[model samples]
Target chain A: MICVENISKSFNGRAVLRDVSLEMQEGETLAIIGRSGSGKSVLMKHAIGLLQPDKGRVLVDGIDIGRISYRELRTVRRQFGVLFQGGALFDSMSAFDNVAFPIRTFTDSTEQQVRDRVLRCLDLVNLSDVGTKRPSELSGGMIKRVALARAVALEPRYILYDEPTSGLDPHTSTTINNLIKGLADQLDVTSGER
Target chain B: MAALEQRLIRPLYSLGRYALLLSKGFTSLGHFSVYRKNLIVQCGRVGIDSIPIVALAAAFSGAVTTVQTAYQLVSPFIPPSVIGAVVVPSLILELGAIVTGFILAGRVGARIAAELGTMRVTEQIDALEAMGLNSIGYLIVPRIMAGIIMFPVLYVTAVLVGVGGGLAAAVATDVVSTGEFIRGARENYLVFGPMFGLIKSFVFGFVITSISCYMGYYTEGGAEGVGRSTTQAAVISCVYILLSDLVLALVLL
Candidate 1:
């Protein structure tokens, strides 16, 4: 479970999050709905240990994320996956390499194992045939799915989606929403919490 | 009275921030290899691409040094051999260090600042941070490592090019025989002097890389910000390299 306790973040003396507190249990799909500049991204960043609160703490599975060292933070980060709004794919790498990045960086998997795992993740996102394409060549929905595949490449216990359906058509958005629902259900079955 | 306090306190706060940044940069060295591939790319861009200009500058500097020394040696009390001695020491101590540093400021320093400043503006650095990676380790450490390794190698190349230019000037003017000039150069080849040049190059590399990275990292705005950062990196690296060279010469010489 991830718990945020009275988290307050300010920039240049202006408060963005004012004593915000929340808890996310295992296997739960909690959609953060807010208008523009509603601090939705900041809240997500804080929850995932990407940003620190000025006046509170964020605990990921009983570990205080903000105060831990970077080395320890990596371990915590390994349990969570983030699909950025912009995809954030390394432009220099192919889709296959992009999906395999986290596995290569954090795991001791052999090259063949990494390749097989990346292919499996790509298959889950229904992008099995686009592994050789760059992010620039993909359509909006395709890029998002590739990014999602990269995010879940490590088989993370938790996943954070930032405007995953923001730029797509309604039909594509529904497809993405269905994928999110399915993944959340899988998490529930595996973790027995959420 | 309150305004005076604010003025003094603001600079103190800036200084504190600079100190904190330096400490963070030093601590980040252990994770330098994370960006090794990027560093290799950057080194090729900065060092190898700029070799033609560096060689041109070194050649002209060598010719000018030869001319000046030859003119000054016309005194009855001064032997012509003293010209090589004077040029050798000056080249190793001042010309070698300062010229190479200036070249790097124009080439490598500006490139680093502009590239990183673009990355900063484009939110790439923020993306790396959001992934729980240390930005310093992911970006600056590799550049620093590359600068330190490559600067000395470039300085040696500069020395060879400069000497070849001096030989060319000598042949053109017939001021000294080729054999005589070569003999004089061989006699004045002090190992310690070139060692000083090597040390200066290393120090200059640190200055260039640190100042460029700092300017790039703190850049704001957009294209204009990147341009300003590049200019600042080049200017600050050149100034710091010259100042550090003087200090090292005083201590080592």
Candidate 2:
């Protein structure tokens, strides 16, 4: 569970989020609907401790995240999977390596295990054939799908999608939406926050 | 009043942020293998790739110095050997060092700033942070390490090439006999001459690379911002090089 209490955030003294409050419980498929520049992403970013609110507290489970040490914050962050509006995939890395990055960072998984998991995640996202491609080589839709494959590579407890369906054609968007739903059911994800 | 405060306080804020980033780069080393790989890559970028430009600039500058020194200082009263003595020390202590510093301040500094600024604007840095990675340890430290390690080496190479050019110029112009020039070069050579150049360049490398990294790492806006940061990195690095040159000269000379 995550709780945002009276959160307020501003940039250059201009408030973006004002007195916002919300709670998200486990196993919930939450959708944040707002027009562009309506602070939807900003609010979602604060919920995961990515962007701290200037006033008010974010409680991940029961712990006030801002008060904790960086080590603790990082540990808390491991539970989250975020697909930024832009693919935010490492342009320098191949698709396979990007998906394998989190596993390499956090787990003592063997090379074979890492490869198997990466391939499986790519298969899940239907980007299995383009594992060797760099982000630049992939189309915009391909990049987003590859980024989504990377986000779920770790089997994160909560997945945050920022505009996952924003730029895709109807077919591609539907495909992505179905994958999001299928992955939640198959992985038994505790929370699918969009 | 606001503009005045901003002018004064902005630097302080930037200084605080720079120091914070430096501290993170020093302390939060994520993995040794990752750091080693990044360091090697950055070393190639800063050192191996910069040789041609540094050599070319220093060579011409050294040649001009030799010609000018011979023209001005040559008389029956002063020995031709004095040209060698003056040129060698000048190249080792200031000419070669400052020339190499300037090259790196523009080239490596802009490259670092542009690369990092692009990463920041493209959300790569944020992605690293979101993935529970120490972005500073991953990005800034390797570039900083490369700068500190390579600057002195490039300086040495620059000084040697420059002095060689000076010697060639002297020989061509009949400014000084080969024997007289060599004798004077050996005669006035102090242990501190090369040391001063090496030390100054070593610090210069850090200043150029780190300032550029800081500027890029915190960059905002977008493509235009990357362009602005790149220009700022080159300009600021050059200014800092001149300032450091003055301080090093006052202390060492």
Among the numbered candidates, top TM-score falls to 2
Cα lDDT of model 1 by residue, A105-154, tens digit = 66789999999999999988899999999888999899888988887787
Error of 1 at A2 (Å): 1.5
Cα shift from native, residue B94, model 1 (Å): 2.1
CA shift of A164, model 2, Å: 0.9
DockQ of 2: 0.60
Query: What does the lDDT come to for candidate 1?
Result: 0.79
Report the lDDT tens digits of candidate 2 across residue range B74-102. Answer: 99999999988988888998988889988
Which candidate leads in lDDT? 2
Q: Docking quality tier of candidate 1?
A: acceptable
List, residue by residue over B127-246, the lDDT tens digit for candidate 1.
566555677776787787778888887888788888778778776876666776777776877878888999998999888987898889878999999999999999988888878977
The residue ranges of model 2 lying beyond 4 angstroms of the native Cα positions read A191-194
lDDT of 2 by residue, A1-194 (tens): 88889999999999999998888788677888877888988887786677888999999889999898776787888888888888899987999999998898889899999999999999999989999999999988889889989988899888888888887899989998998888888887755445
Measured with C-alpha atoms, the lDDT of residue A65 in candidate 2 is 91
